[model samples]
Target: MEIRAIDHIELFVEDAEEPAAHLRDGFGFALAGRGGAGTGLRGCESVLLRQGGITLLLTAATSADHRAAEYVRQHGDGVGVIGLLVDDAQAAFAEAVERGAVPVAPPETVGPDGARVVFASVEGFGDVEHRFVSRENRAGPFAPFIEETGCGRGGGGLLKTVDHFAICVPAGTLDATVHHYREVFGLSQTFEERIVVGGQAMDSKVVQSASERFTLTVIEPDTSRDPGQIDAFLAAHDGAGVQHVAFLTDDITTAVRTGGERGVRFLSTPESYYDMLTPRLGQVGVPVDELRELNILADRDHAGVMLQIFTESRHPRGTLFYELIDRRGARTFGSNNIQALYEAVARQQAARPAGLD
Candidate 1:
C-alpha cells in the first residue's frame, strides 16, 4: 500500500457555510463544490474549497445522531477525516484493518458522469478517520458526486499544498500513536524532540511516508506537569484531535501579507529571536528584516532553508489554527522553528486567560 500526498481534509463544523466562507475570503480558497440534504447527502452538508494543491471539505451534520454532529459537539469544529491518496483504496483499507486499525468504512464507489471514485476509511486518533481514496475522475478538484459549483480551484494565492499536520494525542498515548502510523501506514520516525518552555513540556515525534510527501508530527503534553497549550487543546477538544494543518506556500511573504490584509491574524515571534537566527542557520533564504517584519520564523539545515508562519487560533475554542510554510529544499520539519514556536505559544498563553480570547 502506497500513500501519496494528503488527498483532502474534511473538517466537521457546526455550520459548514460559515467556516467555508472564512477560508474562501480570508485564505483565498475558492469554492469548488457543495453537497447537502437535497443532494442525497442525508443529514450532512459539505462545502468544498480548493487552493493550490489543498482542498478542504467543510462538513456539518444536520441531525444530532450524525457522527459529525457528535464530533462537533465534543471537539468544536475539528478535523474528522484525513483523505489519504492511495494507489488502491480497497487494498489500503484491507492492509490497515489487518494491522489492527479500526475500520470506519469499507470500500465503496460513488460516481457521476460514468467516472468512478473508490473510498474506504480507518480510524485514526480520537474521532479522526483516515480515508483511502482513488478516483477515475481525478481531473477536477474533487469527484463529480460533489456537484461542482464552478468556483474552480483556489484564488490563485501563494498558498500551495499541505505541508504537514500537527496531531496532539493524549500524554500517555504518544508512543502507541507513533507505533500505529508505523505499523499501519509503513511510515518511519524521522525526528523526535522533547521541549520545555515555562511550565509546559511536550514530546514530539515526526513520522512520514517513504517519498516524504506526507508528514505527521505527533505531540503529547506532559500529563504530570501544568497544562500547556497541548493540554488545553486535549481538554477543550474533549480528546485527541488535529492541532493544526500546515499549508505550503510558494511565497510566504506574500501569503502572510495577503492573509493579514484579509484580517487574518498570525502568531508573532520576538524580535530578539531574529538576532540569533543567523548564527544557527548561517545565511538563510529570506533576510532577517523581512522575517522580522512579518514575524515569520526561518530555519535551515545542511541542505537549504525554510520559512514558516502560523496563524492565531481561528476557532472559538482555540483548538484550531494553521501554519503557512515555504520549503526551499529544507527536508526536515524546522527544528529551530519548532523551539521558536514553543516560545511563541508560551507568550501567547501568558497574554490570554483560561478561555480562548
Candidate 2:
C-alpha cells in the first residue's frame, strides 16, 4: 500500500469538450490525448489535459447505461476518480479490500512488457473512487485506449503540481473519514483545526502519504452553527465531493496575472485585509502592493511564507473550483488565511440571489 503520488484525476462531466476548452484556454493546460467509441472506448468520450505535473481526464457519457452518466446526473460535473500512483497495483488493491474497502473494479493490465500498466478501483468518499495505478513507462500514453494528440510537450510552466485537495463531508463523518484514510490507505494525520468565522464554524483535518506527495484537507460543517457554503455544496451537489483542487506554482505574481489575462476570475479580498497587512505580518517576500492588486492572501508558519488565491467557480452548481498556491519554503497550508478565504466565500454566497444556492 505504498502510494507514490497522485497519478491523475478523472472528472465526470456532461460534455467533455466544454470544460476541456476552459482548462486549455483559461488555465494553461494543453490537450494531451483523447478516447471515444472510435478508439474502442464504448459508451463514453474522454479528453486528456496536462500541465507540468498535473493530468486531468475529462470523461462524458454518450449512453445512459454508463457510470459517468449517472454520476453527472446526481452530483453534477465533479471529480469521479482520484488516481493514486502505487508501487504495486495488485498488492495495493488486495490490501485495501482486506482492510474493509469496497472494491469497485478488479485489477486490469494492458500494454507490452516495457510499457505495461495496471489499474484497479476502490470506493472513496461518497460517489468518488480511488483508482490504484502502476506503470512501467512514465512517459507513455495515459491509458492503452487514449490516442495521443502530439501536444504532450505543450504544457505551460506556470503550474508545477497538485498541492492538495479540499473536500467537504457531512458534519459527523469527518473523524470517520480521516480514520478510513489512515487505516486503509496508510495515510497519517498531519494537522487538524476548527475554524470559526463569525457564527458559522467547521472542523478540518489534514492527511498525507508517506512521501508527502498526496494530501487531502478533509472538512466538515458544524451542524450546530449557522448554515454556510459547505452546507450549500452538499445540497446542490447532492452529497459530499471535492470542493477545490489546489495547484502549486513558483511565482504568485506572474501566475495570478497570467491566469487573469486568460479569463480566470479569482475571488476578491477586501481592502481592509491589506490595510492591516503592514502591522500584521511584517515584511513579506512579495510586495504588498502586488498582493493587494491580485487580491492574494499570505500566511507565514515556522518554516516560511505561502501566498494563495481562490478562483471564482464558474460551475453551474458552484460546487467545484481551483486554487493557485505559491509556497516559499512553507511546509504548512495557509492556516491564518483560512478565515479570510471563508469570509470571502461567505460574501459571494450572500450576494447571490435568493434561493440560488
Candidate 3:
C-alpha cells in the first residue's frame, strides 16, 4: 500500500494532436512518444509530452465504443486517469479495493522480460480513475507500446514537478470525497478552509501522500448561499472533475514571462490587490512592482512567502485550466489568497459570452 509519486496524468481529448500541440507550443512540452492502433493500443491514439519531471499523455478515441470517446463526450477534454507510482501494483490495487474503493481494472503485466511493468486501476472522483503503476523493471520506455520520437525538449527547466491538483466536486460530496481519499488511499488531510466571497461561499480541503509529493485540493460550492463559478463548473462540466493542475517552479516570474511570450493567457489581478500588498504580507521575496506587472499573486504563511498565478480557461467547456506556483519555503497552500482567487474567477465567469455555457 505504499504509493511513491505521481507517475503521469492521462487526458482524454477529442483530438490528441490539438491539445498535444497546444502544450508543446504554449507550455514548452516536448513530444516524447506516441501510440495507437498500429502499436496494438486498439481504438485510441495517444501522444506523450514531457517537460522536466512532468509527463502528460493525451489520448483520443478512434472508435465509438472506446472509453476515451465516452469520456470526451461526457466531460469534454479533461483528465481521465491519474497514474500513481507504487511499490507493488497488485498489493496497492488489492489494498485499495479492500478499503471500499470501486475496482476499474485488475492488475495486468505487460512488456518484455527485464523491462516489464504492472498496471491496475480503481475508480476515483467522478469519471476520473487512478491507475496504479509499478515500474519495477524500468528498462524500457514508459510503456512497451509507446515509441519514443525524441522531440526537442523545451521549457528551459521552468517547471519542476506537479505541485497539486485542484478538484471541484458537487455541493454535498466534499466531506465524503475527502474521507474516501483518507480511507481508501491512506492520504492525510493536511489543510481545510471555508472561503466566502460576497454572497457566495465554498469549502475546501487538502489531501496529500505521506511523501508529500502528491496533493489534491478538493473544493465544493455552497449551494445554499448563491450559485457561483463552482456551480457553473459543475453544470457545464457535467460532474466532478479536475478544475486545474498547478505546476511548481523555482522562479515564477521567469515562468510567467516565458509562458506569456508563448501565447499563454493568464488571469489578471487588479492593481488594488498590490496596492495593499505591503501592509498585507509585508516585504516579499519578489518585488511588488514585478508581481504587479505579471499579475502574480503573493502570500506569506508561517513558513515563508509563496507566489502564484492562474491561467484563463481556454477549454471549450471552460472547465479546465492551469496554475503556476513558486514556493519559497512555504508549506501550506495560499489560504490568504483564496478570497482573491475566488473573486478573480468570479470576474472571469461574469465576462464570458452569454451563450458560451
Query: Taking the tens digit of each residue's C-alpha lDDT, what string does model 2 give over 130-246?
Result: 999999987777887888787663356798889999999998999999999999999999999988878888899999999999999999999899987788889889988999999
Tell how far residue 355 is off in model 2, in angstroms.
6.2
In candidate 3, what are the lDDT values of residues 45-143, reduced to their tens digit?
999988877889999999999999999999899999999989899999999999999999999998877777999999999999999999865434688
lDDT of each: 0.85, 0.90, 0.90
| Candidate 1 Cα errors over 4 Å, as ranges | 151-155, 350-357
Better of 1 and 3 by lDDT: 3
What would you estimate as the lDDT of candidate 1? Answer: 0.85
**Alpha-carbon TM-score of each model against the true structure:** 0.94, 0.97, 0.96
lDDT of 1 by residue, 62-87 (tens): 88898899999888998999999887
Range of the 10 consecutive residues with the lowest summed lDDT in candidate 1: 136-145
Cα lDDT, model 2, residue 119? 96
Write down the worst ten-residue block by lDDT for model 3: 148-157
Error of 1 at 125 (Å): 0.9
Ranked by TM-score from best down, the candidates are 2, 3, 1
Q: Over the full model, what C-alpha lDDT does candidate 3 score relative to the true structure?
A: 0.90
